[model samples]
Target: MIISFVQTKGGTGKSTLALSTAFSNHMNSAFGSVALVELDPQGTLRNWWNERTELGRDTGRVSFHHISSSQKEVFADGIKAIATHNDLIVMDIPGESTGKLHTRFACAVSDLVIIPMRTSTNDEAAFADNLYPIIKEILKVDPGKKGCFYVLPSFTHPKANRDTIMGYFTDILPPHVGCLRTIYPDRSVYENFNREGATLADYAYSVRENKRHSKQALSAAGDVEEIARAITQMLEKEHVSAKKEEATLRG
Candidate 1:
């Protein structure tokens, strides 16, 4: 399965979602191997992988590859190559400056394209104006592409703002665009884990830090696990649906 993490605006935690999804898959052993393709110009995913290596963490289940925006063909080839060896391939896409061709290409090959958005007026407007159009165009080109598109509400606060954003999405997205039930709240522990070059689970038994870090690590793990469960259910439903469709056609 090829999953692309994308959004129209920056600071929406797209790369973080990509990393968390990859980590979750690795922990569950749901995939034989997972490859994280960093298509973002900032190379945030690549940097995160390097940091994990520097920290001497277990990076065996996930491999990170950097792909330049100029190399569209190479990107396509890389996706195909990774799919051969890995059961899951997660692509981190640039948020602000993605061109038409690049967006279409990623959407074309992805089994799922996830757009992470924060609860904000600007984010809602951008999603409606920029991201929705691109998604529509991609579907137009390949209507039968067996891919699921989702708009994940990220960095959600337990406030009215979150509800407002949820209402907006419910109004706009079609029935096929799955709504991710897991809302990732904004927390400092996530940033700390990113800087430490490890996931929340990795720091659970750390000897260096005190009790606070360990507690925070456990909390973050809980949140990530919830999101991961939602994602897994979505993918499993797709798989089951596809098999049923095949059987129906055969009958």
Candidate 2:
């Protein structure tokens, strides 16, 4: 399956969520192998993978391959090449309006396109002005494939007013976009993971050895697991829906 985690605005945890989902799927063997495609020019996800590999070589653990490309043709070719070998491909897109075409192409080709947004007025406004328009264009190009798009609430503060924030999207987001039950809390584990070049899934065993620190870390990890499961379920349901659509067309 091809899953692209994207957002037009930066600092919304797009790369982190993309890498974390890819890592979680890889570790769980949910897919025989997973490819993390970094389309961001800043190369955040690419750098993270490189650092993880270096750490893994020193510590003896699995590391992910980072595919980097900014050109749309190059990006498409890279995705095609990686998909040949991996069961699941997760893409991290650049955060800007210039990449909207590429992002739309990825969304059109992907089995699932997850748009991660933070629960803030600014973030919500950006989504409404920028990301939502691009998503609408993507849907215009592939109307029959509307079920593949989803909006995930990420980096939400535990104490934030959820109703007041999410209420704005009531009339905006498409019906195909599922409301994720799991909301990723704004925590230090994400920062630590980015700084340490390790994912929560990557540090699970170590968390078991440390009690106090691991308590919060483990809780965050549980939240991540819930997010991953929610995504997996969505993908599975999309797969079934696609199969039924194909059958109906055949009939």
Candidate 3:
């Protein structure tokens, strides 16, 4: 699966979603592998991978790459080569539509595109004015692409007016837009995941740092599991559909 976490609205936590999804998928699989392609110039994911190595942790079936602008075509070629050998490749990218680097290619090739937004007026407006246009443009470019598109609500307030946020999404985007079943609350566990250089799946089994019983880690573990399951279902469905289409063509 080639999953890309993207948004045109900056600071909406696209990197967080990409890391969480990538590593969660990594730590759970018995034999499946994950490769994280960091297209974001900030290099947050690249830095965290370094931290994980310094901690003497098993980077286990996971690799990180920081792609520079001068080498986008090379980066794209590398990602395609990796995809053939890996079970998952999660691409983390900046939240901007117009960039000098080659992001339109990334948008075209993703198997799944995730857009994260916070529950606020600014984010709501951005989804309408920015993210929606980006998605629309991608479809225009690749009208026959088979991919899943999602908008995830991130950094949700505990006391947030849930209905109002839901209403805004329903109003701005068309109805029946699929959202991740779980919302990422503003939690310290997510903050500490990379700070601790571990995924929530790792945290669930991390008895060394008392992460196994850490209340914050424990709470977030369920969220990660549910999201992973959702991702798995989507990927499987897409594969099955593709196989059927191919079989029909032969018939």
Candidate 4:
């Protein structure tokens, strides 16, 4: 499974989500092993992986690569090679539309493309103004794509009007565009833990040592696990369905 997490606007937690999913799968052996690709010029994910490695964390099962290229052909070739060698590749690209054809190529090869946005007014407005057209372009450029796009609501708060916001988003979302059932809440633990170059799954501290943090820590960990599991299962279903379609067509 090749997965790409993208958003046109910055600060939508796209990098964090990509890293979390990759680490969660790596630590859990979620997809046997995983490759983490950093295509973003910002190199945020690369820095985090380096810090984590320097902290003596084991990244044996996780392969990390930072490819700094904007040329469409180079990026397309890079993605093709990565997809060939790795069963799963999670790519974090630049959070802007001008990153060029690499973004569209990534979407073309991906098993799933996650477009995360916060529930804030700015994010909503940006998603409305920019995202759909980008998706439209991807379909035009990569017309043979077998993958689909999903809108992920990130950094949602309980105090906000989530239902109303989601309903509006759903109403406007075009066909084949879906929403993720799991919403990533704006939690301090997610920020604080990752700031120290540790994933929630690999936090190293005992889940039971701190009584006050026990439930919250475990719940946060569960959120990552749920996402990893959901993504893996979705890929499996697609593979199975694809194989069946191939068999029917051959018959």
- lDDT per residue, candidate 4, 1-251, as tens digits? 78888787877777877888887843347566678998887788889989988988777567888888767677777767877777789888676655545566667668788887765678767766766677777778765344468777777773456576578668766766777666677776676667657776666364567766666666677777766676676677667877887799899
After the best TM-score superposition of candidate 4, give how far the Cα of residue 224 lies from its true spot, in angstroms: 1.0
Q: 43 in model 1: Cα distance from truth in Å?
A: 1.2
Order by lDDT, highest first: 1, 4, 2, 3
- Candidate 1 worst ten-residue window by lDDT: 157-166
lDDT of each: 0.74, 0.71, 0.69, 0.72
Worst 10 residues of 3 by lDDT: 173-182
Over the stretch 1-251, how does candidate 1's per-residue lDDT look in tens digits?
Answer: 88788776777887887888778743357777888788877788788788888878888688888888576788888778778888888888887666655566677788777778765678778877877787777778766554478778877763336567667677766655656766777777777677667766676666237777777677667777777677767778777887888899899
Provide the lDDT at 28 for model 2: 55
Compute the lDDT of residue 39 as modeled in candidate 4.
85
lDDT of each residue in 1-251, candidate 2, tens digit only: 88888788877787778777766643355667676777766777667767766776332222244545555677677778877887888788777744676576677778888888765678768877877787777777778777777777777775556565466445456566655555767887777755557777556556777786677677777776777788888888888988899999999
Candidate with more favorable, higher lDDT: 2 or 3: 2
Candidates sorted by TM-score, best first = 1, 2, 4, 3
Where is model 3 more than 4 Å wrong at Cα?
25-27, 70-72, 97-103, 158-168, 174-177, 201-213, 245-251
Residue 92 deviation, candidate 4, in Å? 0.9
Quantify how close model 4 is to the true structure by its C-alpha RMSD in Å: 3.0
* Native RMSD of candidate 2 (Å): 3.0
What TM-score fits each model? 0.86, 0.86, 0.81, 0.84
- Candidate 3 lDDT over residue span 1-251, tens digit each: 78777777677777777777676743348237888888877778888888888888777777777775656677778787888888788888886744624455566777767667776778778677766665667677765453467666678764456566666555665432456555666776676666657776676666446744576776776666666676677667767877888899899
Candidate 1 C-alpha error for residue 187, in Å: 0.6
Candidate 3 lDDT score at position 106: 66
Tell me the spans in candidate 1 whose CA falls farther than 4 Å from its real position.
25-27, 98-101, 158-168, 207-209, 249-251
